[model samples]
Target chain A: MKLLLIITGACLILSFIGDRRKTALGLKKGAMMFLKILPTILTVIIVVSILLYLVPEQKIAGWFGEESGFDGYMAAALVGSISLIQGFIAFPMAGVLVQSGVSYPVIAIFITTLLMVGIMTMPVEARYFGWRMALIRNSLAFVFALVVGVFMGFLWNLF
Target chain B: MRFIKKHGVNIGIIVAFSLFAGYSVYTDYLPGLEILKGNFRTFITELISMLPLMFILIGLFDVWLPKEKVQKHIGAGSGIKGSLLVALLAFMQAGPLYAAFPVAYTLWKKGCSRFNIFIYLGAFSTLKIPMLMFEIGFLGVKFSLLRIVLTMPAVIAIAFIMDRYYAKKSFEIKSLQ
Candidate 1:
């Protein structure tokens, strides 16, 4: 967060030096963009919150734990796809799962899909990139996330 | 009226959720309300933390970086260099996936190649420096490294496929524009 502030501060300073009018225009454009997307953002947040409320985290961990097998991978992917936790929170939660005997492959799939696919952000993505691009990118990411999970598992077992 | 027409669905969804929350509270379903409030707070904080900076940077990019300059680096014939540059920029970023959209839109308008733009978004979604560090700390070096190694190729391949598919159908590009 501090990093963002620093960067914004620097940009504002630089903008003043370079062109004050442009700087003002930049701020206006930024605010406008924010307003334009506010609705979609709010909707996504509500949906995510509802999902979080409904899904039991403990049940999820159990389904993805050791001996869960292929079902575990699917479960992890599904849960990861739906949830919108930040990476900071996600990695630690995943770490706990790892220590608690959730297989690496499942964890890998969970993390990969969580970061890459973003079911929750599809509306925002579609708004910008069009539904075709957004859908294609996400579908491909989902398939590749599975491949990465399998490969990570293979590599882990080998060594 | 036009704004209402355009945002009617979103506004409706918001209203529905608000009513649901109100009902939940009236029924004394405190847990659901608590969860909703907590999630809302986190969502707002995330937005407050990142959106301003992202938009400001995008605004600055729009103001300062001319189309010609953007095109020279990442447009039609930019090839490998363009991909590399975008990937680097994306890797350096620290924010949620939603924050990347406006920047991507700006890049697209600035004439960045669709392929490199995919690479940029791909890298932004995963492989960010802070995210990687967190992964390494929790998941260990081997797991983190393996995911990174595999992800890069996947990102590139997806970019290639999407670029080709979009090229074949200019309608997609036109729609986005």
Candidate 2:
């Protein structure tokens, strides 16, 4: 947040000094864009909150552990792909799972899919980037997450 | 009426939330209300903190940065340097994945190569520095480092595949612009 503030402050200062007209225009454009996307933003936030509420974390963790094997990775990836938990909450929770003996690869897949594929944010993504790009990108991310998970498992074993 | 029509989805969601809240109240289910309130509060706080700066940055890019310059650097045939620059920029960003969408749209409209845009989005999702730090803190150095190393190549490959696939289709960039 401080970084954002610092950057924004710097940009504002620079814009004011460099070109006052552009500064005004930028602010206006920014506000306009904000308004334009406000509905989508609201929908996404509400949907994510509801999803997090419904899907109990313990249940999600229960679906993936060291002994769960290939099925466990797939389940983790599926859950991660759909859920929209924030990184702050997710990382700490994942950390606890790791300590509790969940396979690192499963955790990795969970994190990868959680970040890369956003089923909940699909509407927002499609709104911006089109349905084709949104769908293709997400599908590819899902595949990559699986591949990466397997590789991470091998790497973990090697070391 | 036009505004309502345009925001129909959002309104629908709001109505759903209200009905849920009403039902919770009727049933004396206090926990549901508590969850709703807490979730809403968190969402609003996140929005307040992130959206303004993101929109402002997008505006600044739109108003200040010349399309030609952006195109020259990251457009088709921009090579490895363009990819690296975008990857670095994505890594520096500190926000949720959705926050990257507007900026990516602006870049796409400005004629950034499809490959680089995908790379940018991929990097934004998983390679954020702050996120990496958090991962390291929780998952340890080896785990975080391995994921980072592995993800870079995976992201690039996905970008290439996406660019190739989309190029064949009449994927018009003009509609959004």
Candidate 3:
């Protein structure tokens, strides 16, 4: 966050020096973009955070815990696809799971899906690229996330 | 009526959430209101921190980035160098994936190839530098590195696949743009 602030600040200064009018135009565009995106961002936050807060970590771990079978991995992927689990929460949770002996593939599936497959954002994305493309991207992303996870896990075992 | 029409989706969601939350709390099955408070705080904090700066950056780039330059760097047939550049762009970004969409759209307008656009989105999903650093701290360097190595190929492969699909269809991005 600090880094982003510094970079944006520097760019704002450079932009001001380069052309005040364009900088003002940029600010206006920025404001417009923010307003346009507000609803979708809020929608995602409401759905994802609510779903996240609904379930206890222990309950989640129980269902998708280290001791869980393949079902746990599948369940985690589905949840990750639908939800936005912030890195702050997800990475630490994953670290804990790792220490607890959850296999690499399980964590891999979870993290990859969380990053690559966002069902919540599909409506907005589809607005730009069309539903067919959005659907293809997401479903393909889902398969690739799992593929990457399993591949990473296999490589980890090899070494 | 005007206000409701403008805010329909958002209002609808809030109403649904309110009903669900109220029932969950009333039934004593969930701490819906409590969770909503906690989650809302997080939502606000994250939104405030990310949106303003990110949108400004996108706006600035949109204004400043030359079309010829964008095309020369990442347009069709730019190949490996283009992929690397797109990846670097994605790495610099830090926030939710939703935040990257507008930037990607801008790039598309600037004539970035469909393949490179896909690469940018794919890389943004997983290669964020700050996030990677944090992940490494928690998951170990080896684990983090392996995941990146494994994930990059998959991302590229999918980008290639999607690019082909888009190109073959002569996907009319203009319809929406």
In model 1, how large is the Cα lDDT of residue A72?
A: 88
Using DockQ as the measure, the top candidate is 1
Q: Stretches of candidate 2 above 4 Å error?
A: A1-63, B1-77, B172-177
Worst 10 residues of 1 chain B by lDDT: B68-77
Better of 1 and 3 by DockQ: 1
Model 2 lDDT, residue B137, Cα: 55
A6-119 in candidate 2: lDDT tens per residue? 877898899889999998998899888678667666666666566657766565456676567789999889999999877755775576566445789999999999999999
Quote the positional error of residue B63 for candidate 3 in Å: 21
Q: Score every model by TM-score.
A: 0.60, 0.60, 0.60
Q: Candidate 1 residues B17-81, lDDT tens each?
A: 88988888889788767866775566656555665566677666666754345334544435787
C-alpha positional error of residue B56 in candidate 2 after TM-score superposition, expressed in Å:
24
Interface RMSD of 3: 8.0
**TM-score, prediction 1:** 0.60
Query: Candidate 1 at residue A37, lDDT?
Result: 62
RMSD score of candidate 3 (Å): 8.1
What TM value does the first chain of each candidate achieve?
Answer: 0.61, 0.61, 0.56
Candidate 3 residue A107 C-alpha distance from true site, Å: 1.1
- lDDT per residue (tens digit) for residues A32-133 in model 1: 866776676667667666765676656555777656778888888888888887775577556655654578889889988988888989988887777877
* By TM-score: ranked, best first: 2, 1, 3
